[model samples]
Structures are given as C-alpha cells and as structure tokens.
Target: MTTTPPPTAGAIDCDIHPSVPSIEALLPYMADHWRDTIVQRGVHDLETIAYPKNAPLTARPDWRPAKGLPAADVATVQAQALDPFATSIAICNCLYGVQLLMSEDIAAAFANAVNQWMAAEFLDRDPRLRASIVIPTQNTEMAVAEIERWADDKRFVSVLMLVMDENPLGRRLYWPIYAAAARHGLPICVHAGSAYKHPVTSVGWPSYYTEDYAAQSPAFHNMVSSFICEGVFAKYPDLTVVLAESGFTWLPAHLWRLTKFWRGLRAEIPWVDRTPTEIARDHFRLTLQPVDAPPTAADFERLMEHMGSDEMLLFSTDYPHHQFDGNAVLPEGLSPALARKIMVDNPKNTYPRLQ
Candidate 1:
C-alpha cells in the first residue's frame, strides 16, 4: 500500500474514538443517585457492540494504547491520534454501551457519566479536542436534556446517536431530539452501530461479524430514507446530519434510487416537497474514513465524481479503529483541492459549532 500523507495544518478531524477508560472512571462524573443505583444494580461496564474490544478491526496494533483499550486514555490518544495526525481540531465520537441497557434510567445515567467524562478527561485537556454529547436514545426527553446540558459548551460539537436506533430515525418520536440539536446549532451525528432493538437486517440477525459489518451500509441507507420521507429536513431546515465511519461510495446510488421513486410517490408524503437526493446533498455529511471504495485509484476517483458534490464528505481517521493502516487515513489519489475540502472546509461547514 502506498503511504498516505499526514494531514495539513488547520485540518479538522470529524470523527475520533476516545474510549471510556472504565466504568469506574465515569463514577466521578455520574450523579450520586445514579452512581449508587448502578453499583447497587450490579452493573460494571458499558461496552459497545460495534467495536468488540478484542477485534483486530477495532484498533490497529501500533495504534493500540500501552495499557488500556485503544484510545482509552488521553495520553495514548495524544501520542497515537492527535499528535501524529497533526489535528488542529478533532471531534470525539464516544460510542459507549449506553444504548444496550435494558432500562432507560440506567442508560441515561451512563450517558450522563459518559458526557461528563468526555468534558473533563478529553475536551478540557486538549484545546483542539471537541466532543459529541452522547445521549440515551431509549428516552427522547433524556436525550434532549443531554443536548440542553451541553449546548453551551462550544467544545461539545454535536449530539451523537446510533444509526441502527430503535425506530426509523425520521419518525415523529425522534423529532424533538433533532429540534434540540438545531436549536443549539449542533448537528446530529449518526455512527455505524446498533441499539440492537431489532436485527440489523430486515430478514433477521446474521451469523458473523462480516454479516453485521456489511449490514451497516443498509442501515445508513434506511436512515437517509427515513430522514427525508419523514420530513426531518423540512422540519429543521438548518439541521445537519453527520454520518461518521459511514462509507461515502454507497450514497450516490442509494440517493439515486430514492430520488427515482420519490418523483412518483411525492403525493403520498406531501411534506417531502423536494427530491430525496436534493435533501441528502443539502443536509447530510459523511465521514471519509472507511471510504470502502474499490482498490484502484481510478475507481475511487470515479466514485468521487459520481458523488458529484464535495460538501458531503468530511475528513475522519476513526482514530484507533483500524479503517486503514498507519497514516494512510485519507483515501488514495484524491486531488489536493478535494483533499483540502474533505479535511478542512467540509467539516467546518458541516458542524456549525466548530469554530
């Protein structure tokens, strides 16, 4: 593999994983009531299914921190991700296992712990670092409360949610969450992961990790469709939706298919006045990590051209999660002009809170 170059100065990393060092680390941040409840309830850790701690894909060997999970501690992140990448601003997408909890109360407790932990441990430590406000989607009121709590923190860039959430994300039930995000000028970041309420596929649960991995693109496909059809863009015109660690190559075709059917079905969803592709191009921004394009540079170039717009792609290394080997984080053969946009311009544009 040709070595990808280091990032230029002033580049903003749209996605970086800062692992929860431990459940114990969050206790300091948790409300005493919740902390006591958690300990009394026998809960210890909040781990995400999207990244199994032991999986090779979770972290490249060299990027792994010396003593903890990849990117778990601030020092490891500084050495392995921020310093090496020369990041001017890096947004943390902490995908802790708050979603997996059976009780909304417990999930909200952990979510609070996670966000508080982020502020003190990561954002406060590094001026260049910003974070998404992780919320417990099992409860919308609680999720919006999370947004309200962190809205004033410029370092808290967006509200984080899983793509494979319980409902099709566009439903009315989820609108309040988007409303809050828009009110605060923060985008809703949808990462590739599941709440595991339903099988990732329409058919059912798959047998292996490969099946789960491949299923995520389809979840993104559905997310876009649900957002557009349910009038999310129409409802919150200024709201932006950031897709982290989601493949950009699939979007052009998915939007094309949606647009094709939308013209015929416009009357059914009267609120969806515009074409689906138009809504996507305007409202959605996807991360550049796990570009998932074909190996050939020519094919990758073709895919970019097919995407037909530069605004939708944002630079992301998906820190410590081995999307690519070493410094080869940027996709190969991208023109320098496009590279600049992907790295610096697009991210700044997508996240209004990023200064």
Candidate 2:
C-alpha cells in the first residue's frame, strides 16, 4: 500500500471538527456509572436545554443537523495535510462541550468520553492530528479532574470551553483548569455554541441562521469583556486563551471603550493592573473565519493593524461548517508571507503541540 505523506512543513489548520455520532462513541471507554447514564439518558440535544438557574439567557437555535463525520476518507485529510500550502490540522470537537448543560455529571462524563475517544481514535491515528480536551464547566471538580487526567498527553493541545454563563472566566472555580493548562503549557480555547444556557443578547430569538451568525460576535464580545473585567488574564498571567469562532474586527473598538472606561473607573476593578488592550494583546489570541460579507482587502488590513500583532490572529476555516470557504475568503492581494502566518504559523505558535 502506498503511504500518505505528512502535511507540508508550513501549514496547520487551527480549527477543524471531527464528527461523531453522539456521545455514545466513547461509552466503552467511560466508567461503568457514566456509561450507564449515557445509555439511559441517551445524548441530550444541547439546543433544547434550559439555562442553569443563574446563567445568562440561552442563545437562539437556528438548528441544523450536527456535522457528525465527513464521508471523505483518510486520504482526503492526508491530501490537505500534504498540500504544499497546508501543514497540520488541529481538530476541535463540538458536541463535547455543548453537552455541558445536560447535567453536571453527565456533562463531565460526556467530556471525558469525547476526549479519550478523540485521543485514541483521531490523534493516535495521525501524528498530524491535534485535539482540544472538552470539560463540563457545570461541575468544576469533574472538569478539573478531566483536565488533570489528560494534560500530560501531547496529542491534546487545549481545553475547550463555551462562552456562556455570567460568571467571569477568572472565577476561582476555573483556576484549577487554568493551572492544569499552564502545567501542560497548553492554551485554553473558548468557542461559541448553544451557550444553550446563557444568551447575552435580548433580541428575542433571531429569525434566521444568518441573524444567529451575526449575533455570535456580540455575544463573544460580552463574554470577552466579562473575562477582562473580572481580571482573568491578570489572575492567570501564564495561561493563554484563544477566542475562536468570533471574528477579529470588533476587538479594536471594544478595547478602546474598555480602556477608556477603566481609566475613569479604575476603582471598580482594582485588580486589573494593565490596560484592557494590553492584556488582550498580550494574553489572548483569536481565530478568523466566516469573514463578514463584501470581503475586502482593506478590511482585513484594517483588522490586522488594529490587532497590533499579526501573530495574535490565527486562521480557521470552521471546516465542514458550511459557512467556511477554503482559502477564498482571504482578501485579494494578501501577501503569501501574511497568508502563511495567518493560516498556519500563528496557530502553531499558539498551540505549540502542532509543531
């Protein structure tokens, strides 16, 4: 049999999702009690869950069937990996974290199952495949346990969390997870999804998928702001956080407003020692994809200029998510060097395991 070559030396896809039937795929690897719960309750559809008592409003659901798995063979991924322009692919699984609202115990079990399965089935299968470890934020102890359990595995690159809940990212409850990531030298990546329990907007359910798509950035902004105001970056100086799925354009304006407010009301958040922009610029990285309509080179340039560091903005196709357009959304006239950095170098640097 002919062997498939590894991805080119310069390419790395920071965001990719390996589809799974449901949480059941990992049942055999789960503990007896957890496996029983999975078999009994079956998988909960995250979009249908209610918000935790004190959590934020639920995000609107413009439902679509889960993009479970692709029909393409391993050779297809190998082709993309080996494409001279592509280097490695880091796959982020969805349902894993979105299932958190189901029940704390089940959520954690689901997370453990998914991580172990991904580690065994995907990452173990391909040296080029890197994955995010999902945890159930609803139960911090279980979440921390799973983080500690897998932090040493090089195949696991980051801890994935959803942007929901009113609690600040810097809360003491989350510190253990941060410590685990710091111990492993892995970044924590936050993605938007059902936030099923926490909706930041008051639009009374968007009418269409496009509206929901548009709302993701604002919700992300709110979550990011909560993290900053709560001094998450300040509290966990060594930990890196990546805000994925939300585009980068709003960042500059939000930072400006936040810093201005902070300058006037420093007393409110005395723990925040550095300006919001500095904290964001230094500790946070963001993924770029689903670039807003009328894509223009100038817009991309402006966003890059505002972010102040090309390295902080990573490329993500949000592959198999339908909204993604491979390579085409990149603005015309973007230099190969910049393209290379956005597509691969930045992600590799942020998630060093990819290297």
Candidate 3:
C-alpha cells in the first residue's frame, strides 16, 4: 500500500457517496401520503438494493462503522473522506435504491425525498459539500420537475441517474431531463448501478456479484453509444455527462470501435454528423476512481495517449468505497500538471456550478 497520498490539496472530488442510513431517515422528507403508505405497508430499507452495504468492496474497513451505514452523516464523511484527502469540495452522489422501485409514483416520491434529504442533511450542513439531485428516470415529467426544484440551488451541481435504467438514457423519452439539465447548466451524472428491471448482462442473468459488477462497463458503453447515435449532443450542444465510477481505461478503445462503426452507419443516424469520438470528447467527462488501467506506468502513459485528451478525466476518490489503498487516491505516472488538471481544472470545466 502507498503510504504517501497524492498531491490532492484543494482538489474537487467528483464522486463520493453519502449512504442513506435507512428508509426511515428519508421518511421526514417524503410527502404525508407517501410517508403514511410507507409506514402502513412496512416498507423495507432500500439501502442495500443497489449493492450489498456490508460487502468488503462496498467500503474500506477503516471507513466502515461497526453498525450502520458507511457514510451515514456529514461529520464522518468530513473526517474519513474530506480531511484526509485534503478535498476542497466534494459532490455527494448518494446511491440509495430510489431508482430500483417499480412503481413510478413511489419512485418519484422516494427520489424527491432523497433530493430533499440531501439538501437538508448534507448540502445545508457543509458549505464545502455539494450534491447531485437524485431524480426518478421512470417518469420524465417528474424527473424534470425535480431538476427544476433544485436547479436554483448552486450546491446541487448535477442530476444523478443509474446507468442501467429501463431504457437507454439517450432515447428521446429522457431528453427532457437532459434539456432541463442543460438549461440549468448542470451536468447529468450517470453512476454505475442497476435498477434490476432486466438482466444485468445482455445475454442473461449473472449468478455472482462479480459478473454483475463487471457487466457495468458494457452498460456504460451502450449508454454512451445511445447518447451519441441518438443525437443527444446535437440536440443539446452545451450539455455534459459525467460517468461516475465508470472505469475509463476502456474508453479509448470503445470510442475507436464506435467511431469506426458510425462511419458505415452514419446514413442510418443522420443527426450524428461528427464521429462518435468527437461527440464523446465534447460532451462526456469521467471520474478517475476505479481506474482500470495497465499495471506499468509506461503502459498507463500509452493508455492516456490513446485517450487524446486529459480534460475528460475528473478527479475522484470514490469515498468509502474500497477503490484504492490509504490516501493513494491517484494512479501512478501522473505529472504534477496532469494531476492538477484532473483534480481541479477538469472538474471546474465540467461542472459549471462549481465555478
């Protein structure tokens, strides 16, 4: 393990998770009817629906508590995530299972409650802490409404959605959400997780957690292709999308493959005038946590060369998630200039509200 931390002082940490303790914590934020329904029906906790909270991979041992959620409150997050890494500002991307509920109305209620709870519990408590507004992608109107509600609050920097939603995110059905995000200058942050509406893999259901986890990279590829081929960038030119915990080592190769196919299929998708790589370069930014890179520093440098741009990677620790050991938040072989770009410049450029 690396004993020396990265030169991360005053860095903008892009993807730290603030776990909701339980469904009970959000009850106060929900509407009276929804709260009553939840109580009457004896609703179970949704905390572990996305990923098993107690799993070793879910949190580092030192970050986890003996009993309760990993990042249940702001003070603990400050101590474990912010102070150690010397993070100047961090965006709280809560990964509760609000997106997993089948009922659209229930999902909307929970999403609203989550956003409300985020504002009151996290954003309001710490000036340095910002958050992504959790929206229910199941219903477009409700999703837009949620964005509008939090759009004025500068602390809520982005709109959060699960990568594995019911439909490919770039389908016109979800464009309204993107439109709202663009209008408000908020980036759409897609995090790795599943709603379980379909099998995690395209072929069939996976039996193990590892398979399901590995399947997320492919899901990201599909969504990025969806966004590019579906003319999302053409429609909303100023919009930006952040892929949190979406491992980026595969990006250069994926873009090459996608851009190559688009040349042959450009007639089918008339709106996608530019190559997929160009579109991705302009519209997408990815978090640096969970870096899937080659082991050697020289190999990693070659991978970065293939990427074509350093601005696409925003710095992140993926706080409380066992992504890296100790304070070795960054990968090796990064020059001080490149490290600064990833940690500060890229984040400021991606998230307009942060500036």
Could you tell me how far off, in angstroms, the CA of residue 342 lies in candidate 2 after the best superposition? 2.1
- Report the candidate with higher lDDT, 2 versus 3: 3
- lDDT (Cα atoms) of all candidates against the true structure: 0.88, 0.66, 0.91
Off by over 4 Å in 1: 1-5
User: By summed lDDT, which 10 consecutive residues of candidate 3 come out lowest?
Assistant: 47-56
lDDT of 1: 0.88
Q: How many clashes (backbone N, Cα, C below 3 Å) per candidate? A: 0, 5, 0
135-233: candidate 2 lDDT, tens digit per residue: 888777887888888877887888888665435566677877787787788888877655545444555676555565567778777767777888777
Q: What TM-score does structure 2 among the candidates reach?
A: 0.83
RMSD of each: 2.5, 5.8, 2.2
Error of 3 at 220 (Å): 0.6
Best by TM-score: 3
Clashing pairs in 3: none
Per-residue lDDT over 301-351 for candidate 3, one digit per residue giving the tens place of the 0 to 100 score? 899999999899999999888888888888887888999999999999999
Summarize candidate 1's per-residue lDDT along 69-125 as a digit string, tens digits.
788878888888888888889999998888878789988888988998998988888
Error of 2 at 182 (Å): 1.6
After superposition, the stretches of candidate 3 with alpha carbons farther than 4 Å from their true spots are: 1-6
Query: Which pairs of residues collide in model 1?
Result: none
